[model samples]
Structure formats: C-alpha cells, structure tokens
Target: MKKLNYLLIAIFTLGLATSCDSSDPAIIDEDDNQSGTTITKAGLITANETWTADNIYVLSGKVVVNEGVTLTIEPGTIIKGAEGQGSLASALVIDQGGKIMAEGTADKPIIFTSVLDNITVGQKKGSNLTIANVGLWGGVIVLGKAPISVSGDLETKQIEGIPATDSFGQYGGSIANDNSGVLKYISIRHGGITIGSDNEINGLTLGGVGSGTTIDHIEVVANQDDAIEWFGGTVNVTNVVTYAQGDDAIDADEAWSGTLDNALVIMGADSDSALELDGPAGSAATEAGYTIKNVTLKGAGASSVSKYADLRDGLIANLQNILAYDFGPTSVVKVNGADSATELAAGRITFLKWEIVLPAGVTSVSSLITGANAGDDTKFTNNATAITAASAATVGANTAVFSWTYAKSVSAF
Candidate 1:
C-alpha cells in the first residue's frame, strides 16, 4: 500500500498548498458555521472508523479506506468534499476489500456535497447552490475485486478517474460475489470533479463491484459527469434519481451485468445522453447481458445534445418499461450501425415496453430511431410506442422513494 499512500499524500500536500486560495479550503477544527466538531479526513484510513450524526465530516483530500478497513457513517450525517482538481481532488474511495457501512434511512438520509455549500448540521440542502451548480468537488469511487471485461484477460485494472501510477486504484478479480458493503438513501451533489480532458469523476463510480454489495435509493444531483457509472459490476441498484447532470445521466461499461431498477433522470442544461451504454471491452462476461428497467427520463434541458441511449461496443442489453419525454428535436436513440443490428438479430439485445411522449413535429416513434447503420434503427425503434403525457406519467420510477432527495425538495421530480 506504499504506492497508494503516496497517491493520497500528493493530494494532501496539494490541499495544503491551496489553503491560501480565495475559497479558503477547509482545515481541521475550522468553524465552518456548522454545529459540533468538523472532522477533517485525508489520506489513508488504515483502521475502523465510525462517523456519527452528531458531527460533520470533511474530506480534505483523497481519503481512502484501506483494504480490510470499515468506515461506517451514521444516518443523517453530513459529509462535504473540499474543492480540488486532478490528483488533488477530494473524494472518498473504498478500495478493493474496504467496506463502507453507510446506510441511511428514508427519513434520515446521508448527504455528500461540496465544502463550499452553506448547508450545515441537520439540513438536507443549502440555498447557496442550485441544480445548475456543479464540479465543486470530487465524488465517491468504490472499487472491488469482482470480474471485469477489460481489453486483456487481466485480473484487475485501474479505475479511470484515478491516475494509473496509484496501485490502490486497481480493481477487479475473480470474486463474483465480493462484499464492498451497503450504501442506501444517500445524496451525492455538486461532484464529478475534473481529472483530465474529457475525464471527470462520476457522482458514484462502481468499479468491479459485486452482487454482495447493496446500493439502493441513491440520488445524485448536479453531478458534472455521469450520475452513476458502473464499470463492470454485477451489483444491482434500485430507486435512483439523477438530476441536472452535465454529462450522461447513467452510464454502464465493461460488461456490467446487473439490473438498474426504478430510476429517474431529469436532464438539466449542458447535459447529454440519458443513457450511454457501452459493452464489454474483451472476452470476459461476454454472454452476460445488461438489464435496466423501470426508468423515467425527462429531457427538459435547454441544450440539444445526445438525449437518448448511445449504444456502442456491441452491447448485449435489455431495457424495459421506460417513460421518456420533452426531448430536443435532434435527439435520437442511437445505435452503432451494423454491430447493434447483428446483436439484435442474434437475440442478444432486446427492448420492451418503452413509452415516449414524442416532441412536436414528430408524429411517430420510428422517427426517434437513428444509427450510423440504417437497418438497425428501425428494429430498435419498434419497441417504442408514442403516448400522451398524461398516460406517460403512469409508467416508470416510483417517485415515493425519492422523497428524501434534494431533487424532490426542489420539485425536480
């Protein structure tokens, strides 16, 4: 873990170097206008640590829970991430074999946001930031020793957001049922800190997570990148809401074979695709198909971008029971020409019961299908049926579970 510690040490040093900045990056025991103690966390946590609701936690730098360590956060606890970029970004990383017992209930959910946020103790959200504000800090990255379909037949690969020099950033193994622990009813906001060009930390990045881990009732608001990106994980998620994302709302890559059930996506300004689905990179988990169901996508953003699924890499997927509406005129459910067409013919890809309220001047669902290859679009678009907005509301995500989210408070639902 020497190399891993060095990775965090670099971030710690960077935080100290930026303490004189105008934002006045938070330090330990600083009066952040919050109640109780402000526990500043940085670098490696080698032993078990429990964060109670009585105090607030601040991630001053890249705080990593080392292998065999357990970092538990009590419900109603508020944790903030310090502002930084690249190697200096502040984030909470659960390395392979580390466990995070951060289980928050519907009534008292855990909150993860930027240190610049004015929200303090016992508050769900702050007035200083809105859904439009983003990239204030880094987000959560959880890695595990599970199977991933990388280019080589490798046992592990470094997660993308972390620099390659850090060996602790590596994730993946033969542990199909690896236990990383539980994350429920948590809201990650104003994250997706920039790492490099076109590379930013996702709101919640699950790299090679396994089925033994539990992630449910999660809400990501104002994430600068993908709200939740699964890089080759078999862990199923439930009841998620992602709103005001600057990039793709949901993304899955490297043969993530799991189900994302009951999800709600509300795209904001500068957002792109509602779904960016990528297939396996290599031979591993090729037969395992991705399953996503029960989604409500509202493409209400001003920006005319990739408004639908951008399927690529010869994915074998199943998307069902979706209700999408209010998209721009240019958006389409894109498929990569012949590869997706071939997959559809081979029964590797399927779509079921998609209901969309077509934008004005579009009278049919067939107009929504587009791809570099002409033949595939027709077949893929056949699953979609046009419906009225009134009937469209009856389908997709159970908004009741997202009552604790900041999105709900702002009526983003």
Candidate 2:
C-alpha cells in the first residue's frame, strides 16, 4: 500500500510540474501559432493599416482600399493572392481616393505572387512556380481621378477587365495632378487572371493615374495579359521591365498622355506585341497622346509570332531611341487605321532613331512595313524622317537597376 501511494504521489507531482512549466511542449506548440500572426485580408480596407514584413498576408478575394484610407506596406513583404477565377478572383485595388505607399528597395523588393506558389516568409522565389507559370491570380489595379478619354465625353469612365456593376471600377476626372500613391522596386509575377471572354486583368493596371503618382523600378513576369497598361493618365514610369508576358508588354490606351522612359520587354511564348499604342476612342481622340523613349524590345526570333509594335486607334506617339531585335521574319511594326496614318503624315506619330535587326529572309524596313494597305505609306520614309535606319539604341534600360529582379536571376536581360 505504501509503494502504491508513493507511485500515485510521484505521478501527481510530475503532472503538477508539467502544468507549471510554461515552456512545455504543448504550450510551445500553442505559442507557435500565436507567435507570428498570419493575417487573412479580404473585402474593403476602410481603416489605415500598415502591413509589416514579418507577418504573411493572404488575399482571399477582392481586397479594396476604400476612399481616404491608406495602406502602407513594408519592404520585403510578400503578398499572395489565392487561386480564383471569374467573379471570385483575387486582386488588390486602390480606389479613387485611396492610397497605397509600397516603397521597396533593390535589395528588398516587394513581391506580389499567387498562393499556389510555395514561397514562405522572407523567401524571394517559390519552388512550385516559375516564370512560365501565368495567370495564377489577379493583379494590382489603381484607380484615380485623372483625365481620361471617353466617347461621350463623360467625366468618368468604367475601367475594363472589371464588371460594370462594381462602381469602384470607374476612374477619371479633370484633375491632372491627382495623386494615387507610390510604387518602387516592386515585382508583380504570375498574375493577370481571366474574368470573362476577352477580359483579363493586367499585371499593373493604372486607370487614370496622374502625374502625382510615383512609379519606378517596376518588374512584371509571366503575366497572362499585358504586363502594364495605362488607361488615360499622366503618370510617367521609369526603369520598367517585363518578361515572358502572354500579351503586350506595355499597352497604352484611352489617350494616356504619360511618358515611359527606359523600358525593356523580353517576349514570351504566347506574347503579342511589345508595345500596343491606341489613342482615345471616338470623339475623345483629340486628347494628348503618349511618348516612349529608350526602349529595347527583344523578340522570340522565328520561334514565336509577335509584333514589334502596333500603332492604331488614332494614336499620336513620339517613339525615339528604340532597339528591336531577334523578331520573327514576318513580325513588323504595322500602323493600322487611316487616323493613325494621318497622324504619321502630320509627324504626330513619329519614330526617331529606331534600329531594327530583322530575322532571316526579312531584309529592309520597307519589306516589313509594306504600306500595301490603304493610307499614305511614304510618310514612314519621308527624308528618313520616321523609321530612320540608324544604329542600335545608345541608351536603354539600365541593367543595373534590375539586379534584384527575377529576370536577372534567370538571365533574361
């Protein structure tokens, strides 16, 4: 009886010790869950909040920053969007009066990827995803109250790739200096989810973003749609890089009067044009156009079908210091529509110092742009005013600025 009582007492003492110890295995397991909080963010962010780098955020659905709210994100933060399709797609949207200050450095760039990616906290790359993985989730969309062209001269217009029922999708106003926010050293990858037929999200959709917004050192990879698109705004971008996109690398439409400086586009397997320039639609065609300089477009060279650039929809652009190389033999810079040709004749749509290295069997620039269709063809070669046979671009995207990018890791440059 004494031995039995001793054994029962020992058991009670051990249980008491285990319960009193704060660092017990069970307690530690419980503390692990509470140590670093994983925030699941969805719906509208009406209050101001700062997302830190230590915490992981999962965007389950459409996450919108409501008006007057500011969402600040720390550098090296990884934001992952859940795998969704149709109306259930996930995206991060900044409403008209909302702001997002996501400022990152070359050493620590902010990454936006998909939840399907196996990247954890503090990791730059994922094991499950690569540059070939496209359309994994939706992309970033920023709407602002800036000038945009509309057929009916409406003060505001609904942005495409979104349902019209979502009133927050509408952008554009008279404020040319409307401020959205800042985005620097940000890399968006594996995005551009398709919502409907011929409607898909872009890597970075700037809808009526104004000059007050600061966007620089941006990189987008493996997007299913255009890497970056500006729908009528004065927001200028610098040091932009796009790789392995499924559509146009850079698409400017709705009379985007912005300037894009120092851009590099490396074509993907299913890519279309390196640059697709479309002016204002219908009666709003008289608005200011866009200007692009110091661009290097590397094509797929006989293995892929993609255009160097396509200028149409009455676009008025001034393209200078462009270097296009390794494109398919038939790929050419074609100008469609009579309005675009008229702009070319008027010197409004002009190309200066454009050096193109065509593929085999494609000789002269004239052979590419035959001008066999309607409208004036001589405007492309008037005294070598436009489409001048010049040397390669002396200045393109500074490769050093993209050292921290995924493209650099894969030697895309």
Instruction: List ranges where model 1 is wrong by over 4 Å.
Output: 1-34, 301-303, 372-375, 390-394
lDDT (Cα, tens digit) per residue for candidate 1, span 98-177: 99999999888999999999887788888899877898898999999888899987778888778887657888888889
lDDT of 2 at 310: 88
Clashes per candidate, residues 3 or more apart or on different chains: 0, 0
State TM-scores per candidate. 0.90, 0.87
Cα lDDT over the full model 2: 0.79
RMSD (Cα, Å) of model 2: 9.4
TM-score of 1: 0.90
